[model samples]
Target: MSKRIWKYAFSSALVLITLSGCIEEKNLRPFILPELVNTPNYLVESFPGDSVLLIAAEGGILTRYADDRQYAFTVSNYPVLDQIDPTDVEVLYSGANETFWLRSDSLIITFSRERISNYRDTTAFYRPTRFYFDYCLSDDGVLHRIDYYNEIWDPQSGSFLSDYFLAIHRFEPSGSGLWESVETELSVRSDLLSSPNAVFKGDELLILTNPSYHVSSFRSGEVVAEEIPRESTFDQVVDPVWNTDDVIYGLPSEPAFFSPFDAIIELPLVAENSQRLRLESACSPSADVIGPVKVLKWTDQEAVVYVQYFTNQLTTANEVVGYIYTYGLKDGSCDINSVQSDPILLPFSNAIRDVALLNTELYIGTESGLLVYDFATLTMVPYLKNLFDEETR
Candidate 1:
C-alpha cells in the first residue's frame, strides 16, 4: 500500500473515534431539573395592579423587579455621597406606579418612569444636623417628609438648647406642574427619634415615635401629638401597617425571641380612643410551631400574618420553616387558620423582613432572597433564582 493511502486511512479512523466519543458523552450526560435559586437580598414591597416591584437591598442597591417579561434593573448612584450605605437607605414606591423614592443619608432620589432626580437642601429650611429623614406618600399623591433634630447641649452654659423639633414638608404636585413645597409649623418636641415610623392613612400622616403617635393633616396643617396608651409593657409598637380605614396594625417590640405566643395589636387612629385589640388570641396552631410576626396585611375579608417558625423534628440545619396565618374577620371578629410550609423549602435564616400577597400566591422577603409560597401546592419556592437562571444560561 502507498504511504499517502495509509495516512488517509489513519486520519479517517481518528475522526470516527472522535465522533463516537462525542456521541457517547452526549448520551451519558444526566438531565438537570430546574430548581429554585436565591435572588438578590431584596426587601420585597409591591403595589396592587402594578407590574414593577421595588426593593431596598444591601449595598445601596435599589432593585426594580418588573414583570416576568422584562429584566430587572438596579439603581445605586448617589451623586452627593462618596459611598452609599444600604443600612441607611429607605425606599418608598408610588403606589400602582413605576415611580419610587430612595432616601439615603440626607439625599432623596426619585426614580420616575423616564428620569431620576435627586433632592437635598443644606439651607436653613431642610438642613439636618444629622443625615437622616423619614417620609411617606399620602393617598392623595402628596409626599410628606419629616426632618428630625436632636437637642444641642451647651456645657459652658450648663443648659440644653431646645433645638429638637420635627420640620414637616409637604411636597404637593400641582396641575402637571412642578412639585410645590409647603412647610408646616414645626411641631416642637425634645424626644424625636431618628427615622420614626410614618404611614399615610387617606390624607392624614400617622407618625409613630417611642411613647407617642403624631397624627398630622397635610391639607390644613393641623398637627396632633398624643402619647401611646400603655396597656401592657409589650405595647412597644414596631412596623405599623395602615391596613384598614381607621385601624393601624403593628407587632409588639417585646419578647424578641421565638415564641409560639405572638401578638398583633390593632391601634385606632382616633385621638380620643385608647382601645386596642390583641389579635394573638385568634391564632392557635400546634404547640410545635413557633415564630415571631414578620408582616401583616388586611383585606376586605381577611387579615393575613406571616410568621417564621420551626418544627422540633429533625431537619437540615439550613432549612427554613414558616406559616401563613390568615384570619377571617367577620363583623370585627377574627377566625384564624394557618398554612404550614415544608421544612426543606424554607429560607436558611429567620430574618424574613416583608411579605405581600398577589392572587393566591404569597411573596416573602428575607435576608437570603425573595420566596414565594404557593397556596395550591402548599410549597415555598425561591423567587429570584428561578427568575434570572434562564437569562444566565
Candidate 2:
C-alpha cells in the first residue's frame, strides 16, 4: 500500500476499537438490589405546604423587614449588597470572632461586622445546582485552597481522597477547624443514594436507618450500622457545632407526599405493611415530591428537619420552590415564611433557596439578603456579604 493508504487503514482500525470500547462501557457498575430495612415510615418522606418566616438579623438585635410579603429576609441592611432570593441556607460556619461564611452557588462570603460582597461565579462540587448546600463547614482554624474554580470540596488535607476513599467515611483535619464531619446515605433495598447525611456525635455517629425516622449511634471503631427498632429512618438530620449532640428527624412529604393519586403506593423506607401518614398543606396542584429531606440538626431525642417544596408537576417547564419547613418531636411545627414571591423583583433566575443552622440561629441564603440570620450572637457570621463587597470593590 502507498504511504497515504497505510495511514488510512491504521485510522480505520483505531476507530473500530474506540467505538467498540464505548459500547462496552455503557454500564460500568454491576446490578445490585436495594437492601430492605424493615422500619415504619422509614423511607417515604414529607414536606411542609406553606412558606416559613426567616428573620434577617443585622448584627446585635437589629433585624430588617421582609422585602416582600414573604417572611424571610429578602434584602440586606447593607446598602451596597445584592438582594438574595430566599433559599434554605446551608452550612453556617462561625468565623474569626464576628465573621462567618455562607456557601451558595459556589461562592463563599466573609460577612464581617459590615456588608455583602460581590462574588465570582463558583460553587461547591458535591452540591448540584438545585442541591441546598454546595458548601462545606469551615472556620479560621482550617486552610482551604480554591479548587475547581471553588467548586470542588477541598479535603481538609488539601488534596483528593484517593486509593481508599470509599472505605474512608470520616474526613477530619487535625488543625482545620473546631468542626468535623458527618456522612449519611439513603439506600433502598441495597441501592446507594446520592448524599450520605451523618450526624456527628463527639465520639459517636448516630446512624439513622433511612428505614425508620428513628436513630441509633455508631462510633469510629463500631460496625457500619447499629439497630434502631429494626425500623425508623429519619427524614433529615443536621449536626451543629456542639460536640455532643445530633438533631434527629422525621418527615411527611406534605401536600404532595399525601397526593391521593400517585402517593407512594409503597412507603420507600419502612415495613412492607406500614401505613402511610396523610399530611395537610396548601401546595399548588401537581406538586412533585414534597421536597428533598435534610437535617438542620439531630439528637437522640430532639431533632430538626428542613424541607424544600417543589409544587409543579413533572411537566412544568421549570419548577422550583422558595419555601422551607421545620418540624420536631412535640405537637407543633414552625413555618418561617421568609421568602420572596415576585419572580422579577430580584436576580433573574429560577428561585434557588437554601438554609443553614449555626449555633442557636438560622440563616437563609436566598436571592435577596445573602445572610438573614443575626450575627454577633457568636453563631453564624455572614460571609456572603463580605464576599459580595470584596468583589464589588
Cα error, candidate 2, residue 381 (Å): 19
The per-prediction tally of clashing pairs is 1, 84
Summarize candidate 1's per-residue lDDT along 75-169 as a digit string, tens digits.
Answer: 33444422335455555667544567766765666666545666663334444435445567766545676655444444685455344455566
Estimate candidate 1's RMSD in Å. 10.8
Q: All candidates' lDDT scores?
A: 0.53, 0.31
TM-score of each: 0.59, 0.32
Ten contiguous residues with the weakest lDDT in model 2: 33-42
